[model samples]
Each structure stands twice: as C-alpha cells, then as structure tokens.
Target: MNILITGASRGLGLALADESLKRGHSVIAAVRSPEHGGKLAELRERYGANVETAMFDVTDETAIARFAAGYAARGKRLEAIINNAAILTERGSSIEELDMTEVARTFDVNVLGPMRVVKHLLPLMDGTGGVIVNISSEAGSLHGAYGGDYAYGTSKTALNMFTEQLKHAVKPRGIAVYAVHPGWMKTDMGGSEAPGDPRTSASGILDLIERRTAPSRRFSFVDYSGSAMDI
Candidate 1:
C-alpha cells in the first residue's frame, strides 16, 4: 500500500513511516522542512525507493493543494493518509489565562489542517478505496476531560467532530475515517518521562488500520490497541 504520513520529521510520525517501510509498504513522508527532516532523511537513506519525502506545512492550504495536484499529476494514489501533524502550544494554561492567539494557531494546525488534507486529497483517492487516520488525543474527549491545555484539547475536540462527520460523508465511497489516540509516547510532545514508545504505539496503530474493515459508531474515538475510547 502507498501511505502518506504528515509530520514525518520526528516522533510518532517518523516512527509510523519507519514501521510502514519495514512492512514493505511505500511511504510518502510529508515534513514541514525537507532540508531539516532528520529522521525522515534517515528513512530515505535506509529504505531507498520505498520512502519518498514531500515538503509542505499541514496548515498551508495552498501547499497541501499543490501536493495533491502534484501527486495526481504523477498518477499516484495514496491508499492511506495519517494526519499526524499537530502542535501543543499553551500546554499548561487554564481557560482564563489561555492565549486566544495560540488557540487560533492550534486550531489552524490540528483542526483545519486535517480537513484541508482530506478535502484536497479525496479527489486523488477517487475510485480507489483508502483510510484516513486523524491523530487525535484522549484530552479531546468531553467525557474524559479533566485538565489544562485548553487550546490543545479544544482543537482536538474540533478534529474529532471533523473525523466523525467525515466518516459519515465518505463511507459510501469505501473510505474509512478514524480518529485515533496514539497513546502517551516518549516523544518531544509526550516528553521524556512518557512510558509508551513510539514504535510500539505506531505498530499497534498500523495493525488496527490494516485490520479495520468498516466504520461504526463504536469506533469514532479509539486507541492504538483497537479499544474504543470516550468521545
């Protein structure tokens, strides 16, 4: 399968790319900075033709449209897209102290970014069934909500709504959309103290993606382990 992973420069995104390549799947790793794509570069060197890099910021609509157009022009179809690009600014700020500017930026990336990618790339995926994975967080769950980082959590909530609506809209076309919580991995975002490893989390996520045959109300929000999560 041909898979595209955004934010493939590091952390879970990079790990997902590596895991996909290890499974002999072709990967189109999208990074904001191709020149500084550290682990992404290593994947290219290690996997050769199995790994390709595309430079584009997920928040940039024009860049995403251009990417979709270019891929279509090349007669390529992405079998899966993992919307893994996100920012965690204002991590500990309360609602009262939260910076609205940061909140807007967070929404732009975490919420609108995935929407843009799906909207533009859906054409390229036409006639070819595929999966769309929006990397969401447990923090987004209203039922489980219990903390700070107002902007991040709120953005993820919006993303969850997008995923839910998108699933219903695209199901007839054989496209399955899922909102996944990839666990608290030891990445830059999850911090060094995080117990989960990116490789393990990514591996489980890939397994779920490969085994998932249909969309149901039961799986609107789920973990990498295929367990249902609170939405």
Candidate 2:
C-alpha cells in the first residue's frame, strides 16, 4: 500500500514507517523540514527508493495543498495518511500557572494542524477508499481522570470531535477516519516515564489499520493494543 505519514522523522511515526518498509510498502514520509528530517532521509537511503519524502509542516496548509497537487500530477495516490504530528505544552507546568503562549502553540501544532491536513487531504481521498488515522491521545478522553494535560488534552478532545465529523463526511466517500490513542510510548512526546515503546505501538496500529473490516460511526477511544476504551 502507498502511505503518507506527516511526522515520520521521529518516534512513533518513524517506527511505523520502518515497520511498513520492512513489510514492503511504498511510504511517503512528510517532514517539516527536508534537511532536518534526518531519519527519513536515512530510511530513503536504506530502502533504496521504496521510501520517498516531501517537505511538509501540517500547520502550513497552502504548502501541503501545493504538495498534494504535485503528487496527484505524478499519479501518487495514498492508501492512508497518518496524521501524527503534534506537540505537548504542559510537559512540566500546572495548568493554572502554565504560560498562555505555550497553550496556544500546542493548539497550533496538535489541533489546528490536523484540521488543516484534513481540509486538504480529505478531498484527495474522495472516492479513493483511503484510511485516515489521527494520532490522538487517551488523555483526550473527557470521561477519564483528567489531571495536568492542560492544552494537550483540550487540543486532543477537539481533534477527537474533528475525527468524528471527518468520519461522518468521508464514510460515504469511501474513506475511513479513526482517532487512535497510541499509548504512552517512549518518544520525545511520551518522554522517559512512558511504559510503552514506539515499536510496540506502531505494530499494533499497523495491524488495526490492516485488519479493520466494517465501517461505523466510531468516535472511538482505542489503545495501541487495539482495545476499545470507554469513550
């Protein structure tokens, strides 16, 4: 399958790309920077043209649109898009004392970015029977024990609603939209305290994407193990 991943330069997204390549899938790794996307470049070299890349920052809408048009011109149709780019602003601060600027930045990266990505990519996915997996957080669950997430949780909750709306709009267009909680994996985002690793998380997510059978309106809460949660 031909796949596009937005945050393939590091952590969970990179792990997903590595495993997919090992399974012999065509991958298009989109990074915010071409020169700075070192891991993706390394994969491109190791995979020998099986992996390709486009410079893309999910927050930048126009650039992604232009890139999409170019890929379409080249006859590149993606089977899936992993909207994995995100940021966590309340890494160390209490919600009340947190800097407002940091909160805005988190929304910019996590919430607005995915919205921009879907606005452009969903149209391309029309009639193509593609899959959209938003890398959302279980912290986004309103029914859960909400603690210190602050901007991250709020942004992800917004993303969850966005995923639900997206699913409704695209299901008829032969597209599948699902928000997946990838577990507290050890990554820059998940930090050293995380119990799960990106490799494990990536494997589970890939399996779910591959094995998903029927379509439904699922504003689902799913862990890396593909276990459904009480949303």
Candidate 3:
C-alpha cells in the first residue's frame, strides 16, 4: 500500500508509520518539518526504497496540491491517508476561560486541515479505491458526554461531519472514509496518563481496516477495538 500519514513525526501517527513499514508497504511519511520528523530517516535507511519522507503542512492547501502533483509524477497513488495532525487545549483554566487563539489553532489543524488534505488528494485517489481515516475522539460524541475540552471536542465534531460528507461523496467511486478514536493513547498529545500505548492503537486500527469490506452509512465510527460509537 502507498500510505500517506500526516503528522507522522510522533504519537499514534509515528507508530502507524512504523507498523506499516514493517508490514512491507510503500509509505509516504508526511510531516510538517523534515528536521523534526523522528526515526523516519533511520527507517528509510533500514527499509531502503520502501519508505520515503515528505515535508507537508496540513494547513496549507498550496503545499498539498504540489505534493499531489509531485507524487503522481513519481508514478504512485495514495492508497490511504491517515489524517492525524491535530492540537489540544486540555490544560486551559476552563471552557469559558480558554484562550480564543488556542481555539483557532486547534481548528486549523483538527478540522480544516483534513478538509484541505482531501481537497487536493481525493482527485488522485478517485480510481485507486483509497481510504481516509480521520483521527477522531470519544469526546466528540454528543450522545456520550459534553467534555471540559471544549476546543478539541468541537474540532473533532467538525472533523466527524466532514468525514461523513466525504464518505457520501466518494463511496460510489470506491473510496472509503472513517472516523477513528485512537482510544486515549499515551502519546504527547494524549498525555502521559493516557491508557493505551501508541503501538496498540495503531495495530488495532490497521486490523479494523483490513477486516472491513464495506463502508457504513453512519460513518464507521470505531475505537481501537473495532467497537462502534454513536456519532
């Protein structure tokens, strides 16, 4: 599979990149900064031609368009895109006290970022039967509980809606879209006190994708265990 993972430098995205490489897939490791993307250079050395790195900013539509053109020129098409780039505002004083700047920053990455990614990449993925997995959260579940993390939850909710819209628009062309809850992962963003390790979450999510044959109308909301969630 020719996989493109945004925010591949760390956390669950990095873990997913590692696991996919181990499975002998051609991977395009996408990161905001080449200098900051970790372990990817080493993996490129180990995996030889199987792994390649791409410097991309998710918030920039121009960069994504250029990336799509460049990759197509290389005679490759993206089989999957893991939309994992995001930010959180968990430690703010309170929902009312949260800084508005922080809210804008969160939406830039968590909401609009994925939409921009799809805008450029979806056309290339048209005939290739691609998949788009948005890294979503349980906190976005309005049926579950409203959380203290207002900004993060709101952005994820928007992401979920976008995923739904994309699935509807693309399913006829054999494209699949899903919203994944990586499950309170113990990454820098998930915090040290988080429950699951990054590796576990990545493995489970990969398994779920491999096992699913059809896209769901409800947008395929699932945890790391393949358990469905109300959207």
Q: Choose the strongest candidate by lDDT.
A: 1
Q: lDDT of candidate 3 vs native?
A: 0.82
lDDT of 1 by residue, 109-136 (tens): 9999999888898887777778889999
Name the candidate that leads on TM-score.
1
Ranking by lDDT: 1, 3, 2
Give candidate 2's whole-model lDDT: 0.81
Task: Give per-residue lDDT, candidate 1, residue 112.
Answer: 92
Q: For candidate 2, give the lDDT of residue 39.
A: 74
Q: Over 4 Å off in model 2, which ranges?
A: 212-217
> What are the lDDT scores of the predictions, listed in order?
0.87, 0.81, 0.82
Per-prediction TM-score, please? 0.95, 0.92, 0.93
Cand. 2 TM to true fold? 0.92
Of 1 and 2, which scores higher on TM-score?
Answer: 1
Q: Give the higher-lDDT candidate: 1 or 3.
A: 1
Error of 1 at 219 (Å): 4.2
- In model 2, what lDDT does residue 90 have? 73
After superposition, which runs of candidate 1 have C-alpha atoms over 4 Å from their true positions?
A: 212-219
Cα RMSDs of all predictions? Answer: 1.5, 1.9, 1.8
Residue 227's lDDT in candidate 3? 74
